[model samples]
Target: MSGILSEDALDTLFRHARTHNAWQDKPVSDETLYKLYDLMKWGPTSANCSAARIVFVKSKEAKEKLKPALSAGNLEKTMAAPVTAIIGYDVEFYERLPELFPHAPEAKTWFNWSKEWAEQTAFRNGSLQGGYFILAARALGLDCGPMSGFDMKKVDEAFFAGTTVKVNFLCNLGYGNPDGLFGRSPRLPFADVCQIV
Candidate 1:
């Protein structure tokens, strides 16, 4: 059984964590990016259908390519970030079930038979993985600014053209600039948003 996390750990992962809009000049190394993925990949997904694909846009050229897709609100901060992660959903991810879900060799057939079901599963699991990505980055002492304010078609064309992968969302990763943070937003109380039933 897993032991409970310390209060400090919970604060780092949730309570005090903020969506940063500005970044310090520090860079996030390629090795750290890989490590971030290695940690987040272990998060759960339906039938273990790990369908999230990620692209770390750290180069000037790549950032420029992504610029046109960003909404006006996201452009400046995204460009300033040390790395912007393009979290995408792989529609054909089920094909890998033979390997990812080796215990059930027939798993791929379930998704292959229905394009609609496949698409839903991809988007849902991909979004879940995106959440895990944020937590993993935080655990590694990095901050995140996740956003959906972008032109999906443009992002798909720029990053995943002729491929089964499609952009789900974008997350800027870096050391956050505290001066850029706004007041924390309020959340719905547990009684209002959850139920014991």
Candidate 2:
């Protein structure tokens, strides 16, 4: 429960978890996936709405169903990875507001009355949770390849029909093949990117 990682260890987790393109034919066991979720689920969300939903695609059939939706560049790598997570947001997440925010009885009713507000909130928070999911996967020693090169409508129609959960993004997970990585990209310096008041 107390701090488990030293500063150096935490920094190493960040530096090493790059977007890996190729996998080693290794599998990410179900226990490891569950542990990753256990770590990620506790990350902060607005009003504890906890709306992010993850569908782990591991079966050959499921991956086949997803292949046509991906861009050509992503199809092979995605299919090769041990798992491709379909990250999504539950649009009607506010229905649980009464339980998530019991002290505020009107919270659930506030969003329930407007489908637009519900959708917007779901998109915002679900996106945030997706970010947390990436960091969590990295911390758990899994390589990630988060991608946007896919057909969202087709993905949803194939994997999420008849559900409130709408796909936000896709991530492939497994042991990274170091040979497949491109040179590390650059980032703006803090001095150039930020300003003090």
Candidate 3:
């Protein structure tokens, strides 16, 4: 079994990490983005569905395309970020089950039979992958700002039109500007939010 991660690593991934609203002038390189995905892709998904798709919005042209879809509150920060990742879920992701879940060659048939089930599985696993993306970014020493304040329909039309992918959420990536941070928010205690049963 693997040993527990050290305190420094835990703090880097969780305790000391903050959701950044503003970014420093530093840019996130394309190589870093590729490495981020390389790490996050290993996160598990049900039946190995691996349904999450991502569009890294880095160029001015791409950011402009995303601007109209953003809520007023998210517009400025997103545009200022070095990168904004549009996480998407593919409705037809199950078709790749034969390749992703090779142990169960017929796994694709399960979701193919029911549109509702397929959609559910895609969203569920896609969201899980999005979580993994966040942790992976943090591990790579990048700050993240995840938001759902954009218009989903507009995003889909702008970025995923004519494709089976649908927007899940957006996350901005960069080195954070500490001056832009809000006060640390409180969280529920384990006793209040969880049980040992």
After superposition, the stretches of candidate 3 with alpha carbons farther than 4 Å from their true spots are: none
Task: Report clash pairs, candidate 1.
Answer: none
Residue by residue across 1-197, what tens digits does model 1's lDDT show? 69999999999999999999999999999999989999999999999999999999999999999999999999999999999999999999998899899999899998999888999999999999999999999999999999999999999999999999999999999999999999999999999999997
Task: Please report the TM-score between candidate 2 and the true structure.
Answer: 0.93
Q: Please give the lDDT score at residue 160 for candidate 2.
A: 84
In candidate 2, what are the lDDT values of residues 85-168, reduced to their tens digit?
A: 999999999988889878898888767788888889888989998988888888888899999999999999998899888999
lDDT of each: 0.97, 0.89, 0.97
Task: Please give the lDDT score at residue 12 for candidate 3.
Answer: 96
Error of 3 at 100 (Å): 0.8
Worst 10 residues of 1 by lDDT: 96-105
lDDT tens readout by residue for model 3, 136-160: 9999999999999999999999999
